[model samples]
Target chain A: MADKVLIYSRFPKTMMARFAERFELLDTGGKPAQDVFSGNELAGIRALLTAGGSPLGAEAMDRLPKLGAIVCYGTGYDGVDLKAAAARKIAVGHSPGANAASVADIAMTLMLAATRRILIADQYVRSGDWASSRQSPMMRPQAGMPGRRIGVYGMGEIGRKIAARCAAFEAEVGYFSRTKHDLPYQYFPSLEALSDWCSVLMIAVRAGAETQHVVNADILKRLGEDGYVVNISRGSVIDEKALVAALSDKTIAGAGLDVYQEEPHAPDALTVLPNVVLSPHIGGHTLDSHVAMQNCVLANLTAFFAGRPLPHAVKTA
Target chain B: MADKVLIYSRFPKTMMARFAERFELLDTGGKPAQDVFSGNELAGIRALLTAGGSPLGAEAMDRLPKLGAIVCYGTGYDGVDLKAAAARKIAVGHSPGANAASVADIAMTLMLAATRRILIADQYVRSGDWASSRQSPMMRPQAGMPGRRIGVYGMGEIGRKIAARCAAFEAEVGYFSRTKHDLPYQYFPSLEALSDWCSVLMIAVRAGAETQHVVNADILKRLGEDGYVVNISRGSVIDEKALVAALSDKTIAGAGLDVYQEEPHAPDALTVLPNVVLSPHIGGHTLDSHVAMQNCVLANLTAFFAGRPLPHAVKTA
Candidate 1:
């Protein structure tokens, strides 16, 4: 008999196809556990698969009496109640850097798009503005990447990759992280200093309570009128309201965002802004990234069922 | 009295303000020299300024009999009749490599936008599809930059910068140029071989009679179905009809174009395609690049008027 793994989050059927072949999945279809499965079925579940940004608390864990591991599908595990899991002696595992490259690639995409005003240019061409020789203030010349300052907020896998890419464009790179690493980029002690020095600020910090709303009005103000911000990390890292106000008043020139305060829904105010470029939160949603993450998920579940420690387990405080 | 310099192309007043301060400019407002100036004025003209892409054939050069110098405002001087200038002992100068970095940056912007389908994603969000949890075929996972092959067709200043930027993104860089140089990227003997080996073909070759329509139907077929082409050099490098057909029939994945065969007008058939991303040939239209190119133009004109060889003169065949 195959081990039973409860699916605690909503995922595409195709994404769960591989897992279904290996385990007898008790999928809740993103609903409450008791509503989807009987007490006996829930009680027998030994492991659960979840999106790292979906909330999974102690109450949900208590329902699965035999639960031994909580496996997160992506790099971030912010939505998982780590402290609650720790107290229950439940091991937490995640695909640590599996999607880092893809996420970093999106960061670069957003950075280049915002800095170059590509969306506006695309519209200008499509609307026959170019053919008519109509002048648009938005089509004015912009600053290129060379000699521009790019400040990264975190220096983890994604941040490091972003820094390396920016440096290749001849942009001077700097970063602020909790712990400094021996990298080629200049290190800043605080986010404020980094924002003040750089014209483009890239947010790649991990999502946690300590980092929530760290990039607020003051930080946006520090970026000044000719600055830009690119966020590929969690939406919680920035105060969305403040960002809108900053862009509206020209406090900061523009922004390119792949994440939002609310998933599957960005504010109408943000959507209508001419200076901003918005996309659904898809930083790590690449074909290669999904395969790598699935590999990690399989490895973690296999080890847990085999009565062994997870090779990619996350260390909890 | 200041030296007479005929403005051979239309320029914004602001861009010409600096030149006006030092020269006696006879602005033609992009009109024919005969229509805008008297015979005396045209005959006395010893120097002229022109946009690099504007045509200046022998007839036009003959109109200004005393023309000693033809100063091009940008790196490319393809439209100038080099043979005609050389026969007349008229020196030709251009802002060579002055806008290379800016042009390279646009190449990257177009590459990332097309490869990642940024325009589609932006529409998905703004159209409320993302907010409503709607599925889009275009939103499917894409291949990231890391480990992707990028083939540059030229090794000029712009091509070298594009290769370096792509390399920083962790892409495997390759190229094919007229003469091989000592560079870090793998060099191919021909564009056909380079296109076959790489997934993304970056067109950065100099525009000239010898290189017209080199990337034809056969070359597009070599790229196959999962390939992309980004052209920042000139539209004449690729056959527009072949490119439109390839993109429409899915012979190649997509394209990002900054230039078109016809100035200020792209064909409706090409514009209607969803896979391609278009820009209005603003590759070197950055503030810093304009300033740099203007400085080079000033230097060339200053030297020519002083009865010396033009400082930035282009060696003709």
Candidate 2:
């Protein structure tokens, strides 16, 4: 008999197909646990798979009396209540670094797109403005990557990758994290210091209470008029209102964003901005990233069902 | 008094301001030389400034009998009839490698944007498709850059820079050039072989009669269904009609083009395509690149008037 794993998030059928082959999944269809499953059914579930961003609280964990594992499908587990899980003795596991390269790739994509004003250029060509020889203010020459300073907000897997890529473009790389690692990049003690020194600030920090809205109006002001921000991390890291204001009044040159304060929906102000380049939250959404993450999820689940420690368990303080 | 220098090509007033300070520029306002200037005015012009892509055939050269030097304002001098210039003992000069970094940056921008389907993602967010949780075929997870094969068609300055940037993203780099240099990348013997080996083909070859329409139907076919091509070089290098056919039929995945067979006019067929990311020959249009090219032009012109060898003269066999 296959081990029953509760799917607490609504994932596309295609993404769940492989897992379905290995486990009997009791899907909640993105609803409350009690709404979709009876007390008996919920009590019998031993493990659950969830998107890293979905809210999973202690109360929900209590419904599954037999739940021993909480497996997150991506690098992040921000929405998982770590204290609650720990009190319940639930082993929290996540696919750490599985999506780092892909996320870093998106960061570079967004950075290049925003800095070079590629979206504006594309529109200029598509609208026949180029053929007609029409002039555009946005068509003004932009500074290239060489000699540009790129400040990274976090120095984790994705941050490190971003730094390496920026360095390759002949740009100077700097970072501000909780602790400095022995890397080639310059280390800053604070985000403000990093922002002041670099022209482009890349947000790659983990989303949490400490990081939420850390990049506020002050930071944007420090970034100055010629600076740009590229966020591939959680959108909550930036104060969206401040970003909108910065972009609007030219406090900052522009922004390229993949994540937002609200997922799936970016603000109307941001979408309508000519200088900004916005994309659906897809930093870690590559095929290779998905496969790597799934492999980790499968490994964690298999180990949990076997009454063993999770092979990819997240270390919590 | 400033030496007479004919402005043979139409440039924006701002771009010409610095040149005007040093030369007695007879601006034609993009009109035919005969229409804009009298024979006497044309005869006095000993040196001229031109855009690298504008036509400067033997007939145009013949009109300026005292034309001792032809200074191209950018890296390319393809517009100049080299044979005619050599026969007339006219020294041809250009800003060699002046815009290489900027052009390479654009190439990377286009490659990342097309491969990641960034435009579609941007639209998904802006159009509220993401908020509705609507699925898009274009939203399917894409292959990231790491370990991906990038074939560079030219091993010049721009090509080398592109390879370095791609390598920093952890992509496998390969190349095919007329003469192989001691570079770190794998060198293929021909463009066909390089296309066969790599998924992304970057065209950076010089544009001339010998290389006209080099990337045709057969080459695009070789690139295969999952392949992408990016051209920062001149457009005559690729057969546009064949490219349209290949893209329409999904013979190749997509293309990122900065130049076209016709200047200032991209084909309606190309502009309408979703897979192609088009720019209006803005590869080397960065302010830094312009300043670099102008400096080279200044040096070339100053040397020409001083009866010294053109400092940045293009050697003719």
Candidate 3:
């Protein structure tokens, strides 16, 4: 019999179809009516196709006794309890850096939207307001991207790509990573220092207990009246309430946010603000990104089924 | 006595104040009231502080017999009859290459907005539709900028800056210019060929009788179903009616436009289209641009009064 695989989350239809060809595909196919199967169904599951922030903690891991590998669809795998999976000798694999360019590109998109007031400008023309006045409602002049100081909070793949794009726009790119690197970007040791130094602060860190609410009221306030914030990472990385207050109160000039504290439900506070550019967390959903991610998951799955080391294996330590 | 200067359009109050320090000031000051003076008043007008497409053509030039220079605020003097100005020995001045960075930044902004469906994304969140569905209304996956071919219709300073910015994003930049330069970008001599070769076509050429409506239905249709168009140049460069038909019929993918065929009056056809990102003609209206344009006009005026070659004199021939 083909080895049974638990599809813990939805994969691209093509990927799911391809997986079914090689293994017995089971579990919920993105149906909210049923997410996890009974203990008996998962008991003999040898592998699982999943995504970052999945519900694959100790409880789910305890049920899947035959599972040898958990292949995550996208980069962040914080939901998988690596320590527990390691104790059970189950390797975890994820598509790392697969969507960095897409996410970074979105970050820049948000930056331009907010800074240039494109949202308001579009509305102004659409609403027939421009007919009455040639000048757009007295917006602060956008000095363009060049020569502006851009500070990235997490200098990972996404952050690095953002920095690279910023440099191309002739911006002064800097980062506050955990450890200093020899890269040309100016390094700041702490978030506060980076916030203080740059005109724009980008949040691109992973979401976890340690990083929860890393950007709070104080950071937003420190970013100051002229500063701009753009977050393309996990929504939880920023304190939504604080962000709302900052934008509302003009503590910061504006924001471009793809993710929010709640999925699907954008905060009421941010929804009403004119200075912020809000999206429904579409950082890595590009056509190219989805294809890359699927290829990564398939690589890990194929490597594992053949009794080889999984590509992109996440270290348990 | 200060040389009389007709303020044909509104400049920033600060620029006006500074100009007052140097010369006699005049205008309706952005009011909708009468701008042109009586024929008796026009006879003494020595210079005019105006912008592109102002009513300072041969008729107005004929009226202002004493006018030696028509100082345009920003580039693009197509509205002025250069041959007539040459016949009359009336010099023209415009701030060249002043707002290229800002306009290119906006072009990229509209490209991202149209491809990523950012305008709809923003509306989805604001309309509370996202709360009902986590997935944004099914959109064709936007391929990120990198490796995508960006074609330019004009290879002027603005086009060069745009290509440089695109290269930074890892896009393959090419252009269709009348004269080929030995630059890194691939050069196509014909608009149709460039449209066929590129995923994104940028309209950045100047507007004139010869160049008006250059991007007609044939050019847009050549761009095909997968192509995107971004225009930061004169709206007359595009055939507004043909573009509307193409967009309505899905002959082309999408468009990001800052200029329209008529100022302040957005085309009713484009207003309802979902695949377009529209902005009123505000591409070069930034604060920095205003300052630079004022400086150019001032430089020309100062040089003209001082009897030096007008610093940015437009060649009549």
Candidate 4:
């Protein structure tokens, strides 16, 4: 008999089909499977497939008498209820570093877009503002990436990848971490010093309460008028109000934001500002990444069913 | 007494002071110096300063009988009447390879922007299309640079620099030139073969009658639906009509265009396309590049006045 797996989100079609072969997959994209789950179907589910955004609360945990494992299909397990999972003694696993390459790609893309004034240039061509016979209307030259000093706020997997790409552009790379790694780049013990030393700062730290508002008005001021900030990490890491003020006052040159304090709703101030490039919090949501996440979920469920330690077990407590 | 030099276009402010020290300068920006030139002020004009777009015609060449040299500030002296200058035994010098670094930067920028769908992604965030709490709307993962094959249409200075940048991103690099250079990348004798082999093709050849519309419907078809085209060279290099049709029909995935077919006006066909990224041909217009251009102009004039061989002298006729 196949062990039942309750799915809380949709995955790549192929991977979902693969999961169906291993276990009887229950579909619940918007909400939990309510109708069948209220009966014996709920009792049969021994594992849950969740994502970074889908949490398994204690209330729901109490109803699943046989639930033993929770598999998350993204680098971040931010939405997972760690305490609840710990109380129920359920194994939790998440795909770690699966989307680092794609996320790193966006970091550089956003960096170049903001600095190059890509939006303005695109708008310039579309608006028919260029004189037919004259030289293309001269716009400000970009503060290009080459030779620019870049500071990475965190030196984990994604941060390391970002540094590597920036270095390839001939930009000097630096990092701010508790302790330095075995990298050739310069390291600063404090974030403030790193901001002062670098013109472009890339955020790639782990998200948690401790890291909230880590980059605030003072840090923005230290970044100065020629400095640019790129955040691919959690939105709460930056105080959005302070960032807006800094952008408005020219305390910093510009910013490239992939994450926002208010997801989906970027502050209106950012829309009007010509120097910033904004994207919906999709630093890692590539199709390649989506497929990778599904594969990770499969590996986790397979390991759990075979009475083996989860390959990427996330510490619950 | 200093020899006279006719300044055809505006140069950087500091460079003007540098020129003032070397020669008696004459400014004729909008139209030719009609009144002054007809006067004896043009009598000692030993040299003329010309740029890529601002040409000195046979008529103007005849007026400056004493002209011994033509110093161009940009890399391409496409506009200067080479045959006319040759007839009078005039020394023509242009800044070659001064723009390689900056132009290479834009090529990669366009490559990433178009493939990543950056402009559309930026618009999506601004348009409030992403769901606030759910996973940010899934976007197609760009056929990212890593592990992808990139074909350079011309193996010139700018093309070599672009290949280096792409290799850093882990993309496999190839090239198509009249003849292959001593490069590690795979080389094709024909553009069609190169197009079929690579997913992304960057055009960087010199503009002339022989190269016009080199990438037309046939090349686009060979590149196929997954292919992307990026042009950083002359606008006339690619067939705009064929490019638009390919983009419209999804025959080619996308394009990143820095130059256009019609001087300053981009076709409306390109404007409505979601997959194309357009810029007003400012690839090498950085302030740093401007300073470099001034330095080159100064070098040519300095070498000419000293009766030494011109540093970047272009062969005329």
Listed in order, the DockQ scores are: 0.82, 0.82, 0.69, 0.58
| TM-score versus the correct structure, for each prediction | 0.97, 0.98, 0.93, 0.88
Ranking by TM-score: 2, 1, 3, 4
Q: Alpha-carbon error at B308 in model 3, in Å?
A: 2.7
lDDT of 2 by residue, A1-317 (tens): 89999999878777888899999999887788799889998889989999878889888888889889999998888889999999989999999999999999999999998988888888898999987879898998888888899999999999999999999888899999999999999999999999999989999998887888999999999999889999998988999999999999999999999999877679999999988888887888888888999999999999998889999998876
Better of 1 and 3 by lDDT: 1
Off-target runs (Cα >4 Å) in candidate 3 are A1-3, A9-24, A27-36, A134-140, B10-21, B28-36, B134-138
Reference-based lDDT, residue A12, model 1: 70
Q: What value does the lDDT take at residue A217 in candidate 2? A: 98
RMSD of 4: 3.7
- The positional error of residue B112 in candidate 2, measured at the CA in angstroms, is 0.3
Clashing pairs in 4: none
lDDT of 4 by residue, A150-186 (tens): 9999987889988887887778999998788999899
lDDT at A191, model 3 = 92
Note the residue pairs that clash in candidate 2: none
- Local accuracy of candidate 1 as per-residue lDDT tens digits, B142-215: 88788899999999999999999999888999999999999999999999999999989999999988889999
Regarding DockQ, does 1 or 4 come out ahead?
1
